[model samples]
Target: MANQSELDDHYTRMDKIFRLSLGEKGAYSCARFDGDFSMTTEAAQLKKYQFIEEGCKIKKGTKMLDIGCGWGHFVDYLTKKGVDAHGVVLAKGQADACIKNGLKVKHMDSKLITPETFGKFDAVTAMGSPEHLCSVEQYREGKQEMIYNTYFKQVADLLPIGGRYYCQSMVFGPKMVKFEDIKFGQTDLWKKEFTDEELMDIICEVFPGSWLPYGKEGLINPASKYFKVVSVDSGRLDYIETIHRWTAAFTAFNLQKYLLFASFVPDYLFDKTFRRWMRRFKIQANLHVFTREIFEHYRIVFEKVSD
Candidate 1:
């Protein structure tokens, strides 16, 4: 997958946009939304945190470790609820923000975590981290299962029996097109839609060294040896809604936000590659979901089991 530098550089370029679109908390993951579309992005994000709390059986005084805790929103939520919550992230911008807000967060890779590194925790939650745990290249090299198993074992070692691990991530959906068969700027996937090859390129730029799991089983099977899946839910539609709201947020930008956008004009006008990737990454994610069904989102809770 992506080395630490690649991951850091990728996030450095896009963190500002995420901060603008996701609001003060800087949440960057899918939000929960349904027929009742009245909830704001912040509210929906809190709902997601609530789901994690309930799923992991987190209560007051519970010691919880949040891996890849973007902007520390979940940690903030849990801490306010009287839970002893701590977070770790690889993004510099996110870690700085969380620290500035007086939250307990570390700027480091989650994969480096071990019982020796952080000691045993009562519970662990990886909101959007597992998707980055392995890359497509790693998977092609026959290392996906091994990587996942090792990751699960790390979490297992950090939790006592019956402790929980909550994970939410994007997984390959049904009818997915083969990787090699996917074309650039082609319309075969949809009646009148073109799959921009550049879109994939930009995605690579945006996420650098990350890849998604093939399906829920990709996670469940590997984790089965260490933890038992307690609950699983398809959050695909919720993600679709979350994306639309993000688009609207950027579109409804005000003067202050416009100033923020204007600051990037120099990069847009000069750094052609970065500009194109930045714009396309935002646009293509929504398009791919509707037209290609490239992936599905899932939220799962796994309880540690003694083996």
Candidate 2:
């Protein structure tokens, strides 16, 4: 699983820009456009969150735990809807921002959460977090499935038999390159031409300490020990649109964002690692994988069915 520092390498690096573009409570996950890419980014994100709300049967006064809550947007939304929502975030910048906004968020690992720590939530949601449940090292050591099983078990323990858990994650697609073929950091960033295998490396640099499941089935099978799958759907196309919109937001003219960008100029110019990291964003390797189906997205609702 991605340690706190690894997760922050991505989330915290973009904290200021994300806040400036999406506001203090904006979401960072894929939005649900349902094949209609015309909707504004904000609208689409809210739509996706509402879908999770309905799918989980959340209502006013419903107690919920938002696992890996980024920026506390969904938690804030639930609070506004009268739901008693608490969030657990691993990233320091994210937790600080949430608390600054008076949100009920704890900067702690969700895997450590138990009934004793939080009592029990009426529902649980892990959006875009499970993808980080198994690190590359764990996957290589053949511990991926075990890591996944542990995640499902933790979530299962946090809910009742009928409780719902919503999860959204990315999985490898048919076109995924062989893991061995991925030259994770050998390729020069300035190279104008590259192969899919090399692109996978850039993607790794973009999201280190993380590895994905094979597909929706990879997630479902591990979860089968503790929950029954209630619903599952592909959000690949929606994620493509979401990425496009995000690119627009990040590149759009904003005084705050410009200031943030300016602050990074010194490091970007002198720090090779930081410069490389910043360049990784320009490759849009994530968008590449999704567009080519090298990675698939899934949204699911699982009902607790076992201990």
Model number with the top TM-score: 2
What digit string (tens of lDDT, one per residue) describes model 2 on residues 151-229?
Answer: 8888999999989999999999889889998876798987776688888888888889999999898999999999998
lDDT of 1 by residue, 1-307 (tens): 5666766776656566666766656777788765457898878887888788888989999999999888888898889999999999887888888888899898888888878776788999987788788876786688888898898888898999999999898887775556665443332221343454434533545576776778899889889998999999988888877777877776686776778888978988899666656565555554464345667788999999964
Q: How displaced is residue 57 in candidate 2, in Å? A: 1.1
Q: Give candidate 2's error at residue 95 in angstroms.
A: 0.5
Q: Which stretches of candidate 1 lie over 4 Å from their true place?
A: 182-193, 196-202
| Model 2 C-alpha lDDT versus the unseen true structure | 0.90
Please list the residue runs of candidate 2 whose C-alpha ends up more than 4 Å from where it truly belongs after superposition: none
Clashing pairs in 2: none
Pairs with steric clashes in candidate 1: 2-209
TM-scores, one per candidate: 0.90, 0.98
